[model samples]
Target chain A: MQPAVSHGDRPRLPIQAILRQTQDLPVLPGAIMRVIQLTGNSDATSRAIADAIGMDQAVTAKVLRLANSSFYGLPRKVTSLQEAVILLGFRTVRLIAMVAGTFTWMTRPLKGYDLPPRQLMRHSMGLALGAQMIARIGQFDPEEAFVAGLLADIGKIAIDNCIDGKISLMMQLGIKGGMTFEDVERTVLGHTHSEIGAHMAENWNLPQEIVEGIRWHHNPLGSGNSWLAHAIHLADVLAMVTGYGLGGDGLQYQLCEESLEICRVSAEDFDGLVEQFVGAVLHGEALLEGMG
Target chain B: MDVRQWNLSFGSQSGGGLSSHQFSVGLAEIRVVNGPTLLECQGIGSCIAVIAYDAHACVSGVAHIILPKRLPSSSSDRPGTFMDTAVEYLLNELVKAGAVAERLKWAYAGGSDFVHLASGASLPALELGRRNSEAAKSELSRLGAEVVGNDTGGTTGRDVSFCTADGDVKVRTVHEGEKTICNLQ
Candidate 1:
């Protein structure tokens, strides 16, 4: 339903619904999923992971060459995947997989949403990285946190495909309300990204934690499930503040008190997280470009 | 200065005898068949440029644009066509002109972040110029081409020229009473 208010004012909904409407979400690009499956301590050996990578020679070569590029800021050039993993680490590699494999899909022009690919990629990666920092500060599973952060807005693609003209309309309302894209999602789509993403998770049969992470990412204040969601919520906001990955939602963020309580993540701690997250993401940029 | 010694040339859709590879930022697509060519457009506030060159053929092409993808200046909805499509088209033309994909030297200019100072039409929360630059860079990267020169960003306007014969490009900025050469080193 249209928000029917005059253009000067319109309703903004939560992000859950926006997450509900993703179209052609970039899959984990088989090899990346394979790496995730193989990298476990028990499932496979480094040789196995190497074999899987070697099978897709193109992505592997690209990742290795990228890893060796100036992005890593390595004092010495790394010529092999083993060296890349040793240097960039497995967790970083996983994050890179998620980004490199998926970022391009985000680049598809969202006419209904009026968002270019680069806009969404920057926003999504910024929040994902921000969440990882917050989770690390709180001693939660940072890897899970990063994944949660990355998938926080999976519902947006769905929204763009489902709501016809609403995305662009919401974009206009967003500016009027001083609201972010998420707010527009809520207004136009009725729910928020967290809810939409949560539902998507349920459909995809994603792990229970990821589903909850999607649901509570924006409203972390009242979350009873995991600190990862709250951490991601904070990171999303922080990314906007730092000008890292800005979306339709700019600095019009109102801190979710309940989410803050759920994580017990302090302001001082958050400040530190932002500082460190910036450094890590900056370093990670090269790694993401050169996945191994 | 687009006519200076071994420095510059302007090109458009029609063939020009100026320098073998001079650049033209004017909205016309210019073609050159001899030596090299540099075509350009400048002073783009929220505009982007396309650079397609054949290193083997020693020829380069450029286009300056104002949107991400192309849409009608009137009412056609082509949101997925702008500097990106223009670059792709130019590149395809270069290939037809006997330019190798990997040998093209590429660069661009004229995008500035616009935070609309005045309230006129409803403005979305978009960094149009930044978006344009990103699209251009992404297309170039995908094609294995890197921007060798650029003078992007800021509130000031830009003017640029390209030399096809030698692949020399110049970018100038309008600041106060002087037009300063803005270099991206």
Candidate 2:
């Protein structure tokens, strides 16, 4: 099962050139960007967050719909942006806005990777929910974990946009050549999606931790054993194992054994963790439905 | 067997006199069907799909197995949830469908150790795919069923489609398109 052409013999692009191509990719929506900024600010008020979200009618409608959706299981209807903010809280609302804002692009099919419409979004939501659950268990900030998981594969979008339709060909060659997906990406594209995603996060002004999480999700040890990176890695694997929105890469990514040790999760907990992770994804299906 | 535990959710049903139905066997689920019916396990990673088919009776059963073994404290009643329990339940259902135990042909797929810490990583916890494949083979042998075909122990996820009509099993992967792995007949 050797590749028709040797990987080393294939022409490769420079990382800078690849990044330059991604420059045409859309930036984060203004309202979503503002919400993210305010969410990170210590002195920011719920009113400020609500106003930031309200600035975008589409995002505001989505946030309110999600707040009232069965995903949160609110006792009563959420009538307005302010009311929804008060009920779902700032972080949750911010998450909803971010999800809604990214919904359009995230749901687009990536022919290069063979991802159909909404599949990537489903995977991202699953990863976010799984990461949030693991964060709760590990006593880390669940919100940060959720954000990191949601945007972890964003590099794929950029790469897919940059590489035209050659990604699938590269994937085939790599798999046939017994190379990992990331390895193939690095071989031909000059950098893996993780690295590209990290760069995108940096440009988006995401926190350094989240940037690192995206960078080292495939190799958490590369981040000096960061817990967030490990959590994201585990979440990504769990999403794939549960068969939520799998792409051409499928489950080819590596799961670090030391991630369990770093996150204080044990082998015995695998079944329960999977159950909870699936349950969370199921419960959050309404949120995805609202986006659709 | 609890009737409630028998999950027979159909994915698609074709219209016509001879209706062809497709049943999706999700995580920890087992489904048995007769001719003109297809049972599928999609996007399987780490989890194993243990299939038993009796070509004579045109009956097939699939168990979407997740774990190598069941825990004592585990409250799950789905036999297909664990490799240890899945084989027995799947075999019993096949027998009930008029499949002879000795005549049944077994095929399994989708135990992938794609995600590993490093090359030759030796953590038992991370070897779920290998453990699942081993468990499936051992359990099928214990039941005296003839093991026919398998596509397991790789870093790629697989989608397995089994046609009860002919006992043909097709496996599809991301890199490789769908191909028939075996035909019990």
Candidate 3:
């Protein structure tokens, strides 16, 4: 798609070209990738996944820390990756590994978005926890929702890397012109971060549902109202509401109202949901501290 | 300057260089203070920051309210989590801190609907911001507190700072930067 030349002087690159620069994109760490692959294999055993995660010492340390953190409320300390996998299940271990693998990358400052160190990570954690809770309520796969929520904004990092200094200018212009951030992104870059993020997810061979969740989080209706997309949408809003990471965008995205219907969350229970989400965020924060 | 730094500089300047101590009120949290203390709630989106102050008593309180009402199943002891409970909690804390109940002035910021739904979308759940703001005003009215200012109902998030000594409320948004919305005094 050709982006409108609103800023004629500024260079515009098509989303395809941007994605073609594979080196600029974040590489899913090898250990995490192996775990993800194993997660999809019905024959994969807990010991196999644990051995794969143990290959990365840093990731293993983080996983152990999180497993021992109060977020899990384990009765005893978890000292080994194998024990963690057996106790927390392969799915939860995979989730923890994903968080550990992406922690440093997500914590980097995104000057284009005006997000400082740890701010974006905090927001991702909040969204991950919120999406997990909402997924449980909706009877969806909570683990998948958590991963989608965690990686939803990764496109912003990719955009920041590709555009460098141009994105901040676009953000300012968007705010000044009273346009939504996504609209400004589309106008200037031919794609919003959601689209770029979806492309990246696809490149990383993430599940189709997660790719769609990241792609249409801002406008789930565009995804034919997929439940995962809607859950991520609501979780994104919930993350903002709880004041997780209001960067330059700061609630600039639109909420898809049908998300509630798709997520099977009733209006009467919304307050309770907020309360539950807040509690989950607090728990997630504890896990973050453990990662430190 | 960035909003956070700008808020700090503004606080110190406006409080006559009293070495203001800033306390952040997080989600579903409330903070009450006296002297040159500043209570702040940042990244407020679809959440309300309900501010109450008594100029005569020099006491101020800010609550980061998440919802309109408390749920029956919610066992959270944090009063600031809900609009109705937040008002009652803030008022009680203010009075306990030497602020006169009748002399209290109220103001609020935030409760923005960041989601833009289709025109006919029927999700009432997305209206948490509006409901929070309405419930705040209604609860404050029920308690006979005079609301002096309101900066709410938009599609953007806000960062709100309240000065206990001067009763000045400064609201910052990505679009508007930072500006004092009201002074209860």
The Cα local distance difference test for each model comes to 0.55, 0.77, 0.78
Error of 2 at B183 (Å): 2.8
Error of 3 at B135 (Å): 2.0
In model 2, pairs of residues that clash are A255-B115
Misplaced by over 4 Å in model 2 are A1-11, A14-26, A161-178, A240-243, A250-254, A267-276, B1-20, B31-35, B52-61, B73-79, B87-106, B141-148, B164-167
Q: Pick the winner on TM-score between candidates 2 and 3.
A: 3
Candidate 3: list runs displaced more than 4 Å: A1-11, A16-25, A161-180, A241-243, A250-258, A267-269, B1-20, B54-58, B72-75, B119-125, B164-167
What is the per-residue lDDT of model 3 for residues A1-292, given as tens digits with 9 covering 90 to 100? 1122233234367777877753546777789989998987889998899889989898898889888888788999999888998899989998899899898788776666656567789888887888898899999999999999999999988787555557446656765675667777776777788988998898888889899999988778878778888898888877866667776675345565578787888755767777888888876777877454
**Which candidate has the top score in TM-score?**
3
Q: Sort the predicted structures by lDDT, highest score first.
A: 3, 2, 1
Candidate 1: fraction of native contacts reproduced? 0.00
Candidate 3 docks with a DockQ of 0.32
Best by lDDT: 3
Report fnat in order of the candidates.
Answer: 0.00, 0.37, 0.48
lDDT at A125, model 1: 71
lDDT string, candidate 1, A1-292, tens digits: 1121223334344444344335455454667667766654465655666666666666676667666667667788877767767688776666555565565565454544334445466567767777777776677888878777887876665665655545435544555665544455665656565677677667665567877888877655445647877788777655543344333333134455445555566543443443355455565565455332
lDDT of 2 by residue, A143-254 (tens): 9999899998988887886556575577677667776677777767767788888988888888899999999887788888788999998898787766676667753566
